[model samples]
Target: MTTRTLPMTEPATGLPDRITIYEVGPRDGLQNEKSVVPVEVKAEFVRRLVDAGLQTIELTSFVPAAWVPQLGDAEELLDLLGPVAAGQARPVLVPNERGLDRALDKGVKAIAVFGSATETFARKNLNRSVAESLAMFEPVVRGALDAGAWVRGYVSMCFGDPWEGPVPVEQVVDVCARLMDLGCDQLSIGDTIGVGTPGHVSRLLEALEGAGIGADQVGVHFHDTYGQALSNTMTALAHGVRVVDASTGGLGGCPYAKSATGNLATEDLVWALDGLGIEHGADLDALVETSVWMAQQLGRPSPSRVVKALAGA
Candidate 1:
């Protein structure tokens, strides 16, 4: 295949050529590993991702250290990154007001709040009902937005859940609406257990459209548990979704969802986008190298097909 040098902002595809790839490897990816990753290594991991041209990276989480010791160094990590400017979008995951406060104190410009579309997941992950969880985020989201910080809302299990099975589209739409009402700048619909097919992805987007949620403010996060992540992402792109959440080297899994697996690998997503002539402003070779280096740090080979293929190539 010949690589074309077309303008990034104006691809031949009707879809928006330049998509924002929100990299979540530093926080979501490393959080699932049982081995305690050193904070220095985690910071270095973030630096590498940025060098690979990732504009928005979820740096870390501000949850209780007791709950997620892996990201307990969130403050230190932010300090290491220094002040993040607008458009860079280094959002940290905040579980509550305290977490939001911590992020604000660090001069962080963006943050993400996690919500679940299923009651069981909400109860297990947040210790609150679906409505209660959204309510808890109300103050957090409001506070962040009032402080002029960008807020992103994540609705997990939008397609299916291991425990609850197929999640209702209506439930997801309502939850996303609440998040939007709470002042989230963007909503990332998630297929946490990766059971979503392309059809499911289209239907969910259609349902969201009917509920007045445009694809511009929507992003998709998919795990590759059943190998549908890339296909689902293509469906999302076709629906005009321009933001995607991916993990480097196919890293990350929900600690709460025991059966969940790797996130849509950054390399895989970039490869598909590259082949499609869509612009993501990423250096594919650099991304592959970063994944390979991070895999060495984790003492494992990358699970991404693109990563493995690139190494052999």
Candidate 2:
């Protein structure tokens, strides 16, 4: 794909004074893990994450346990999250109105609404047409915002899809516009199967720009299945997207989406930010320690190069 060049923002130069690390290890991360992390362990993970300077953390999703038994304790997880500091935020995933009610009842401040960029995946994942899902979210987003809660939207399979192969830039732009128009505080474009290259990422950002969604309202959520998350992320950064989604120790993968491994590890993102002189406010050593703890609890080797390299280095 031929890429059109865009004027780059001043790269995030200087040692990162701060980068908001949204910890998805509980919701997106654990949902894909094979081992069901105990509730105590899950809460402990959140506790540790906050201690590591990740103020924005995803607690869990209220989706039916039948859909993701790994996070059946969404309510419990939210309730058990000891407490938040004066300014910290802990967001949770809500599938629909029912999920939103459950999360709201548990005192969630931020909630996420998810939709896929591919129609096929949207139908398969949400069991509804794209229009139907948007219709469903309209009320959900509206209700959440009305309740004084911050609402974020997730756009999955931004670059490509498992069932239909590569997704079109037009498709991504249109869907993302709808999500933003629905009044999402921010939107995360996820490469569900990690098939995105830097070129694909650039085109998608340009398409989003063409659609008039400001760069500040967008985030890139990459899965490292094809080993392209970091470069793709840097491409997003150059486009002025600041927010990013990552999990500790590279945890999480799409159980429904084949070969879509865990997200770009938080450790890896911090490493890149460190090299770029961008501030993330994260304690790398503590973050790595948490990642190792998470990997041990899950009984899996971390997919993060930083984790392996640092542990050995």
Residue pairs with backbone atoms closer than 3 Å in model 1 (clashes): none
TM-score of 2: 0.93
After superposing candidate 2, which stretches have Cα over 4 Å from the reference? 1-18
What does candidate 2's lDDT look like per residue over 1-313, in tens digits?
9553222334454223445677788788888767678999999998888889887888888899998899999878776875667788888889899999998888788999989888888888899889889999998999999999999999998888878888888988999999899999999999999999998888888888888887788878999988898899888887788888899888888878867888999999888787666778888888888888877777777778888877652
Model 2: worst 10 consecutive residues (lDDT sum): 6-15
Candidate with best lDDT: 1
| Candidate 2 residue pairs in clash (backbone atoms < 3 Å) | 14-277, 16-278, 16-279, 17-279, 18-279, 19-279, 19-280
Off by over 4 Å in 1: 1-13
- Candidate 1 residue lDDT tens string, 64-142: 9888888898888887877766557788999999999998999888999999999999999989998899889999999
User: What TM-score do all the candidates reach, one by one?
Assistant: 0.95, 0.93
What TM-score does prediction 1 earn? 0.95
